[model samples]
Target: MLLHFISDLIRNPELQRQFSRDPEDTMRRAGLSEPQREALHKGQLEPVMKHLRAELASLELFAVVWVKAVVQVGSTQPGIAAPGSTLALQVLGDFFTTGAFAVVKLEGADLPAVTRSVENPGQRGSVLSCTLDVPANTPMGVYDVVVVNPDGHYGVLPKAFRVE
Candidate 1:
């Protein structure tokens, strides 16, 4: 089925904004869609893998949640990040007043999730940016951006790209 993100986001700013607001608001908004949220729904490896494949940015080894639904990742490449490098994550979606989703974090080996401008939101800069400091000993492999909130709300958006 064809899903128009912009339309859906515009029609339901609150729905989208919730993803970018504080942890409570994010969880509250996520609760509204728990029945259909992919991140929250329990699934198998293949299904979850497939979902991550489609919900991740090949350009980036990872991605970060934007206003509420968008993710601006880097260009995809093999071994793009050298040891002791900083990974950048970005997103652009509906604005969230409480600021870019509370308690936003990334997961990976020897990596630190760093989020700036939390107290002072990105101001809907047509996009949002975050960073995950990769340890000097970070291993090389595929990864997923798992966004979660305090109220048990979470979702993983599509982030795929083509090399050819």
Candidate 2:
């Protein structure tokens, strides 16, 4: 399933890097069908939506390949961050220099706005981060990170973040 590939890319940094460098090679290794591979290679989400038999908001939007989750600066470890800390996630996909956005949500509730690091546009991957800014009265629990590119493509990290 496409979600499985996305999950693998999110959990495996090496695979993420490989996907960013050569998507076709990575997809092939993942055992994706020719059509699925072509759809993803072209960044077309309609076929994937159809393949999954689900209706998505952006049928033409491109798909993003999540590669790494570095919760804090200079650390590859993901999850288990305290409130008010910056969390960084790396992804391989298409995004506009302007108009792209991300967010952190818990239980279908949006937590706070995420800031996308404007690294070199030529960089191999996109790094997005957010500060857990839930109010002090907010309950402590796991949260999910969602990214939306300028073209309206969305990718959610399956791994949850634990607040301590």
**Best lDDT among the predictions, by candidate number:** 2
Find the 10 residues in a row with the least total lDDT in model 2: 67-76
The residue pairs that clash in candidate 1, if any, are 20-101, 55-157, 55-158, 55-159, 56-159, 57-159, 59-76, 72-90
TM-score of each: 0.33, 0.40
The lDDT per prediction is 0.38, 0.55
Candidate 1 per-residue lDDT, tens place, 60-157, comes to 32323333343223222221345566655444332322333322222434233444433223223323345755666566554444333333343443
Off by over 4 Å in 1: 1-80, 92-112, 118-128, 157-164
Query: Which residue runs of candidate 2 sit more than 4 Å off their true CA positions?
Result: 1-78, 83-97, 114-116, 120-124, 129-132
Model 2 quality (TM-score): 0.40
Candidate 2 lDDT score at position 19: 97
